[model samples]
Target: MESPASNSPRMRLDHLRKEGSGETHSRVFELEPCDHDNWSNPRFGSMNALEILRETVRILRYNSSGFMAIAALLICPVSAVLLSNVLVDLSLVKRLTIRLLLVSKSSGLPLRPFIKQSCQKFAEMAISSATCFPLFITLSLLSKAAIVYTVDCSYSRKKFDTSKFYGIICKIWWRLVSTYLWVCMVIVGCITFFFLVLAAVCNSFAIIGFSPNLVVYAAMTVGLVFSVVFANAIIICNIAIVISVLEDVSGPEALLRSGALIKGQTHVGLLMYLGSTIGMAFVEGLFEHRVTTLSYGDGSSRVWEGPLLVIMYSFIVLIDSMMSAVFYYSCRYSTMESSDGEECQSILESVVVSPQAMDVQ
Candidate 1:
C-alpha cells in the first residue's frame, strides 16, 4: 500500500486534474479526509499510563542519576518531618517538666528557676522549628530542580554534570518557585471555593433541616469537586514545570505553554498523574504493612520503621518524577503531531482546491 506521504497534495492534485472531471475533484475532496487512522495507530497514539510508567522505569534503570535524584528529592521533606517531630517531643517534655516542678513545692526547687529553664527550652525549640521551615523550603526547591534536570537528561541520554545542571537550576530557581506558588494557590482556591459553596448552600437551606443523607451527599459533592480540580491542577503544574526546565521560560509563559500543549490531551496527563500517585500509595502501603508485620511485637521495630519508610519514600519520589517526565515528553510529542497533521491538512486543502485547479476542472 502507498504511504500517506506518497499521496501528498501535489500528487493528489495532479491525479485529480488528469482525471479531468469536476465530480472526481469534489469526490476526492469529500472522500480523502485527513489520514487520522495513522494518527490513531498504536505507534502514533498517545502513551498510556502503563507505557509512561515503563518509560519512567526504563530511564531510571539505565541512568546512574536516579539514586542521587531520589536522595535529593527525599532529604528535605524527611528532615523537616523529623525535625518537627523532635520539636514537638521537646515541647511536650518541657511542659511535663514544668507541670511536675509546679506540683512539687517541697522539692526545694524555686519556681522561677524551673519556669525560666522551661521557657528557654521552649524558645530553643521554637527557633529550631523556625529555621527548619526555611531550610525545608529551600532544600525542597533545590531537590526538585535537581530531579527535573536529572530526569530530562536521563531520557535524552545526556550526561549529567553536577555543576552545570545546578547552574541552570540556580538561574531560574526563583521563576520556577514563583510558578509553583501560583499553581498551588490556584489549586487551593478551587478546593476552597467548593468547600465554601457547600457551606453557603447548607446555611442558605438551614430551614430545610440538614439530615444524615444530606450531609453525606454534601461531603461527596465536595470531595468530587476537590478531586477533579486537584487532578487538573497537578497535571497543569507538571507540564508547566517541564516547560520551565526545557524551554527556559518562566512564570505565566510556562503555564500558558503548558496549557496549550495539553489542550485536548488532558486525559493523558490526568491519568498519568493519578495512576502513578495511586500506584505509589498502594506500594507504599504494602511496604509499610510488611514492615509492621516483620517488626510485629518488637520494641526495636520503631527504629527500623523510620529508616525503612524513608527509603521506600525516596524510591517512590524517584519513580514519580521519572513518570512525570515521560508523560511530559509523550504529551509534547502528541501536541506536535497534532499540529503537524493540521498543517498538512491545510496545505493539502489549499493545493487541491486552488483557483488554478478549479479553473482546470
Candidate 2:
C-alpha cells in the first residue's frame, strides 16, 4: 500500500508475522511524505530578515498550528505573568493603604475592615506566588513542546494531533531538559564573567580616582554589550532545541547541528531576536505603566487590564516562537540547498527509515 501523497519522498514499512520459527509472511506499506514544501516557503532561504519575519507573522496568523501553540501559551506563561503582575500591584496598594491609614489615624475613619482586607490580600498574593512558581515551570515545558510540535506541523502540512505531538515530546523531553540545563549554565557563566570583569575595571578606575560619571558610563556600556550577547546566545540555543526535536538527535549533537545550520544566518537570527526582545519589553512596559497611571474608578478597569495584558503578551509569545521556528526552517533549507540537496534527502531518509527498527509492532 502506498501512502497519501505521490510526489514527495516515501517511506517503506515492512510488517512481518512470525510463523513457527520462521518469518515467512510480510506486509509492506509505503508512506508518502506530506504536501508541505519546506524549501518553497517564502520565509525559507530568504536573505532579507524583514521578509523572514513577515513570513513568520503570516504563518502564525493563518496556520491552525499557531492557534494550538497560542492556547498552550495562555494556559502557562501568560497566567504566570498575570499572577505576578497582580501580586506586584497588590503590594503597592497595600503599602499605599497602610501609609494613608497611618496619616489619617486621628480622623476616626473605620479601619478594621480595610485592615482585614489588606491582610487578606497579602495572604492571597503570597499563596498565588507560591502556586505560580511550579505552574510556570510545568506550563513552560508544555508550551515549548507545543511550539516544536506546531513547527513540525507547519513543515509537514499535517493536522495537529495533541496526543501524538505531546507523546513525541515526552519521548524526547529529557533531551530538551539536558540542552536547557547546558544553555542556562552557559548563560550564567558568561554573565558572571562579564560582571566580574566590569567590577575589576571599575575598581581600577576607583583606585585611579576616576570620575563617578565615567565609572557609571563604563558599567552601562558593559551591560549593553552583555544584553546583546545574551540575546544572541538565547537565539542560538533556541534553534538547537528546534533541531533536536525535529531531527531526534541528542543534546550535544543538536548543538553541533544547530551551530552548523546557523553558520551563515547568524546575523538574521540576531536581528529577529533583538526585534522580538525589544518589542516584548516595550509592550510590557506600556502595560505596566498603564496599570500604574490610569485611574480605574472602581478597580474593575485595573482587574480587566491584567487579563488583557496576559492575552496580548501570550499572543506575542506565540509569535516569537513561530518566528524562531521559521528562522530554523529557513536556515535548514538554505543549508541543504547550498550543500547541493544531498544533505536534505539524507535527512528525510534518516527521519523515516530509522523508525522501523524501534517502531514496528
CA lDDT, every prediction?
0.55, 0.58
Model 2 off-target regions past 4 Å?
A: 1-44, 65-69, 72-79, 82-137, 292-295, 345-361
Clashing pairs in 2: none
TM, every model: 0.62, 0.69
Each prediction's RMSD over C-alphas, in Å, is 16.3, 14.9
Tell me the tens digit of each residue's lDDT in model 1 across 124-207. 444455555554447655666666666655533444556555456555667778776666566567756864665565444443
Residue-by-residue lDDT tens digits, candidate 2, 1-361: 2222322331222345686856564433222244334333322243446756665554554466556555654454655465345434556556655664553232222345644464455454544544454544366545765675655554444545655554565566687777765665666677668757666766666567777666656656876888777776788778876766666675667777787888878888888887777876766666657665664677677677866666666666666776777677667666756665433332322333344412531
Total clashing pairs in model 2 = 0
TM-score of 2: 0.69
C-alpha positional error of residue 144 in candidate 1 after TM-score superposition, expressed in Å: 2.3
